[model samples]
Target: MHLKRFTDFALRVLIYLALHPGRTISINEIARAFDMSRNHLLKVINELVASEMIITYRGKTGGIRLARDPAAINVGALVRRLEGQAPLINCAEPLCPILPACTLKQVLNEAQHAFFEQLERYTLADLIGTKQEKLVNLLTNHVAGGNA
Candidate 1:
């Protein structure tokens, strides 16, 4: 299943913060780094803050950073939070003739469950482990007016 753009951006934001660690990054900087709109990124940032995935600071010198260690942020949990409670399919309003007897929904549900189960096996730390140095270099270069 394809994740929405919002979820994709949310994940990107988390990874970006994970790469930076202690550094407080600005919304504008992130926007520029990812070539995304600041307005769109703000919405994602707000959600991330509310979900306690990241912390925000105010004032001129303020910015954003991860709220906890990367190892503590479960990818499955983050995906679930970002995706919310939306069902994979709207079987209640099914237009198909065999909707009532369909096993598609059940199969899809199982697949989705397995997908998340796999995600749960790894944390954000696991995501950036081998790529840490490369990610750091990319982020550093991106912030310094270079391509990521």
Candidate 2:
């Protein structure tokens, strides 16, 4: 299943903060780095803060940082939180009459499980490797270009 862009952005924002722990990341800096709208990023940041994935500090020297340790975060848990409760087929509000009889629900649920299973294989730490700088630059450039 294709994930929403919001989920994608949320994950990116989290990873950026996770990788840059101890550094107070300004929304402006993140926006410029990713070339995203400050207003939209602000909204995402607010949501992250509310979710307790990140914490916000106010005032002149204020900025954002991860609320918890990167190693402690499971990508699957974060994805689930960001994506909200998974209901891939929405059988409760079936889009088609056949949805009641279709095996699609089970299939979709299995796929969703597989997706989480794969995501659970790694923590934020797993994302870091020899190509970290390259990954960061690529993400920064792409997002800044409004391409991600």
Candidate 3:
């Protein structure tokens, strides 16, 4: 199944924060680095903050940072939470003629479950392992308006 942009952005923002545990990051900085819209990133950041996944501060020194350690954040759980409980196939939409007998919905649901289950084996730390410096340099270059 395809992931929504919102969930994708949430993962991106989380990864960025995980990599830069050295300092707090601002929404503008994240948006600039990723070449994404600040307004959109703001919504993602707001949800993260509301979920206590990341912490935000106000004022001139204001910025953002992960509230929990990278290793503590489970990728599967996070994605499932962000993606919500929307079904893969809407059986009620227009009323599928075979809705009563179709196994496609059940199959799709199982596949989705398996996908997230596999993701459960990983954490933010796993995503950046052995690539921290590379990711940091790339991100830094991107923020500097250079190709990475």
Task: Indicate the worst ten consecutive residues by lDDT in candidate 1.
Answer: 139-148
After superposition, candidate 1 runs with Cα above 4 Å error: 141-148
Question: All predictions: root-mean-square deviation over Cα?
Answer: 1.9, 3.3, 1.6
lDDT of 3 by residue, 67-132 (tens): 999999999999899898788889898899998899999999999989999989999899999999
Q: TM-scores for all candidates?
A: 0.90, 0.81, 0.94
Model 2 Cα lDDT, one tens digit per residue, 10-80: 77787788767699988877776666788888888888888888999999999999998877777887787
Clashing residue pairs found in predicted model 1: none
Between prediction 1 and prediction 3, the one with superior TM-score is: 3
Best by TM-score: 3
lDDT of candidate 1 over 12-80, digit per residue (tens): 999989988899988887897888888999999999899899999999989999999999999999888
Worst 10 residues of 3 by lDDT: 139-148
User: Could you tell which candidate, 1 or 2, scores higher by lDDT?
Assistant: 1
Give the lDDT ranking, best first: 3, 1, 2
- TM-score sort, best first: 3, 1, 2
Error of 3 at 52 (Å): 0.9
